[model samples]
Target: MFLNNLFSKIFRNQNRIEYTTGKAVPLEEIYLSELEKYPIWIYALEEEDVEGQDEFWVKPITNSTNVEAELSTPYILLKIKENNCPVSALLDIENMKLDDLQYWDYKYGNWEELNKLDMPSPIHLISIPSILGKPAVEFSVDIKPKNQTTAIARTLMGPDECKDMYKTLPPNICPVCHTPLKREINPNFIVSNKRSCLRYTYDSFCIVTEDFKNFCTLNHYPNLEFKEFPKSPGNYYFTPLNIFPLDPIRQKIKFEECCSSCGGFKGAYGSSPGFKSKNFTLPSNDFIYRSDIEFGSEEKKSPLIMVGLETEIKMKKFGLKGIYFDDIYE
Candidate 1:
């Protein structure tokens, strides 16, 4: 059956050769809103974009960081440092309705409605990842970084095509991103024996392990789907089916550019989907929820996936490697 499906697969129109590589550049510096005394004002480098945002709020018990290495930069560089303030912060606007968070207009010298395009980074982290007071929400899982043993299979159409190449991981809509760039995906990503699990990039990418797939199936966590790779039986192109809408403004979400043909956002989310509130209802154990916002740029466009507490505990108890959770998203 696998061979029949593979051979019958129709190759889509090939455009340019694949060149999207998901990589993280060094962050200019660490940023957090908790230490600031004044309103958050990012985008200082550009005067036209000079504006004050409602600081992203976090009722934290404490704060900390383990980002000893590099981090994903704001696609356009937002970690601006002022003389009085080391790092300017955005408004603490997460989960709150649009009418809630306002913008500070420098010209009028009065707070006004914020446009979605002008929203700043939502949550800043320098403390414990897990919210101590929350009922059962935990911080991010520890997905292993991409290393020597990892073999990244992409859907980005290359000059030389193979069975592994695809237009989307599920052989359907590329659910993770909203890029204007033409993209072809390899849904059947293969993994190596060296690592128990894999990933060097952010969790936005829908890559996963065979064990994870089995665990989901056995546990009846239905929102996730998987496509196994024949070349490497242990690997799979994993994707989540459930979705939740994202607030483009307050979360630093928007399209830097857009593709004319598709009218899609030109790339994936510049920053991860971060919010400091847990005001929404969690999905049941049978499913997980993905933000309507997708992350990654040309190389990859995917959503930030969030699972409920039940799913989190099950995965932890099952001993899934390279998987972690964060308490940031709404």
Candidate 2:
């Protein structure tokens, strides 16, 4: 009943954190590093006795399905323990077939592995999705400890012992810190002008505010590219490999005044503004000066380009990094 009581108190509860625009600094301002890795989510369950006593009789319910196929994704069933004996932990029956039995004794590290066990005792039914993206139906089961010795022997000593235990990967991570990203769905509006804060969620867990920002990618040079200057007048640098002068190493330690065609020093020995230019102009004039410039026009019959650009024009004006595309049209 404690599980039922705790579940009723916390489920569907929402927490909020407020951040102001402009008042808050960019994530890059705090951390200069980029987000190079993906993040993951974690879930755990509790094992205990029926009356919230130390004696455990609850057996973890393990189930699987193979109605359409020979095997299905596995789901763990949790139960309380009492006197080193096992009590029932059953799930509701449905269109799917359930099999396989594995007992995990937190009291002991080794799990009692069974190939195929009998159907579980049904209690309450829940429709949860399988890891393989299939529909899953589960039944809750009560437990009865098999022994009187270790059932009272316990390790997880707090109310936090009960929880679902599983893990999965989320797509993004904090550009600064590499912690798993969480979601805040339709959270309270912290900033008066904004309707929602940027957040990510998995199941009932979330990464909010500071945690939310950590999951976003820091794009320093998302649109960066290098072009070639003619080695000799009339000769063109076409392929990526053919353009050796454009290489990172060769591009460094440069002489400014050289023939645009021959790329040799004959005129001035000083660096020219035109020697190398950054934030190059794309072929499309309409997309000029946009940090998040789109590549082709819809009427022009070319591939459409989309990239993450700053929402504010001031950021774009200050040369903020963002996504861009080039025209592939003749």
Candidate 3:
């Protein structure tokens, strides 16, 4: 049995492509587009197979909660067919489910015997798309050695690993051509507004323009008053909108800005730089700039004022047309 196992190891090694040979291409040069054309295989191991293997079970401290307690030992392997061979092509299992009874039987019932076989046997194959979708290119194998267990350490692959592998690939290389892709932006897309302001505070007297009046009416402001503007024939004064108090002892101030037409939250600015602005489209077809001042106080009741300004420009849409990856020699 020992002699037979030794010969089997030698045979497997001989079949594997040697790194010294020019035919052995770097895994990074292989793109998902090209890989999708060919079938791949995922090797699932039983939980018992990974027991006593720290490398397989150890979780990184930063991602302990995110990592799955059970490692999906689905190691991906590409299936290559030999030319003019009488043997039948490997069966594609891309659509096969891991939980299927037939798959379970095939994996456990015959895997042991196949592993013990002295001669090369057929390998079950699947596709990357079936397992990972188009984002399969963003994943790679992460292997570490601990007590001789080479099982994958994490179930999910991170973008950093994928980026590191394809470092030689151009930053903007087209997935197919291996050349830089051109990026064009269309400056006409309307921004989708999705945030709401519950309350707001301003330090100075607020001007109620016609736009402001329309905004208040659309937003169901019950207390707002509209007065004809003396300076303009068609403009009106918007008043009584909720405003934050300029109290020196107030710890925080908040406000909401609704769209004049849709009553949606247009955008908002706060004293704190950490405030997140909600999605909003420009009130007018053209770009506009708005500014406001916020008032508050320090712990000792020292008066504080913060000026905030925002420029809402038309949304810009980007398109990727011409790009390519560096030439890959197999």
lDDT of each: 0.35, 0.22, 0.22
Please state the error at residue 216 of candidate 2 in Å.
Answer: 53
- How many backbone clashes are present in model 1? 38
Candidate 3 Cα errors over 4 Å, as ranges: 1-205, 241-330
Query: How accurate locally is residue 23 in candidate 3, as Cα lDDT from 0 to 100?
Result: 21
What TM-score fits each model? 0.42, 0.15, 0.16
After superposing candidate 1 on the true structure, give the runs of residues whose Cα lies further than 4 Å from its correct spot.
Answer: 1-190, 198-205, 268-270, 276-281
Which regions in candidate 2 have their CA more than 4 angstroms from the true location? 1-97, 112-136, 142-330
lDDT tens readout by residue for model 1, 1-330: 000021111121212122122211111111233222211112112122212111111121112221111111111101211111122222112221111222222332222222221324342212122122222122111222222122111111001011224333433343434342332334344443322343322223455666777887787766666666676676666566776555466557657566555566656553443552234454443346666665656444666666655665566567554443443344
Candidate 3 lDDT, 266-303, residue by residue in tens? 32233332221223222322211221222222110111
Please give the lDDT score at residue 167 for candidate 2: 35
lDDT of 3 at 36: 32
Candidate 2: tens digits of C-alpha lDDT, residues 1-330? 001122322222221112111122111111111110100000111212332212111111122222112111212232222222222111212324222223432332222322112234432333332323444334344333333221111110002111211134222423232222322122221211111121111222211122112222232323312222222221111111111011122223233343344333322221111111233333321211211111111111111121222222222343323111121111
Q: Looking at model 1, which ten-residue stretch has the lowest summed lDDT?
A: 153-162
Better of 1 and 2 by TM-score: 1
